[model samples]
Target: MKNVIVRGYDIPAKTMVIANIWAIMRDPGFWKDPEVFWPERFEDSDLQYKGHDFHYIPFLSGRRICPGMNLALPDGMKPEDVASSEAIGLLFHLKTPLQLKATPVF
Candidate 1:
């Protein structure tokens, strides 16, 4: 490993890199009304859901995409039926836990 420079900062060799995804996603400069739970902001976005863009990096992309990305709702549940309310703090929590029945698809 060798020294590297990023955006004018000199990073020592073999340094660990961590992305503050929460801050980046809520950056006012990159998003308008970022605190609001607005899904429509992406309606006109050209960015692919696969995290091709850094502005939004949900579970990353490509070979490093989250393993849980394949998780799906139980049968008979629509997206709109899911609760969207959130309680923000040091960590985000669902204002109300989602109520659902888990029925085996098999």
Candidate 2:
């Protein structure tokens, strides 16, 4: 019914659309200022990460669900230990400074 420009080329539009989730999530119709990283958006919302919500599907959904589901990683090391190790590793290996803020769970 219309022409959709893809990669600078005009393609004939059809009843169905084939688009990646990355593009769909950024669609203005679904989100306002989609380009901005607003973690607080989910702070007050009932948005889900367990594949039930469509607005935010971080781990994908259905057949393509993540294989690391229900994973319980070992906790032999403390949170600070892991954070320090990662920060130091990045500083040495990648020559980048890792910013980390420690906070109590309670």
In model 2, which regions exceed 4 Å deviation? 1-19, 58-106
**Distance (Å) between predicted and true CA of 25, model 2?**
1.4
Query: For model 2, what is the error of residue 5's alpha carbon versus the real structure, in angstroms, after optimal superposition?
Result: 24
Model 2 lDDT tens row, 1-106: 8878878977886746666898876788887888887645765877666747876654468878766544433445443443433334434542333434444658
* lDDT per residue as tens, model 1, 1-106: 8899999999999999897878887788887887887656665978767645764454456787767545667688778878888998998988867765545758
Clashes of each: 0, 0
Clash pairs, model 1 backbone: none
TM-score versus the correct structure, for each prediction: 0.50, 0.39
TM-score result, candidate 2: 0.39
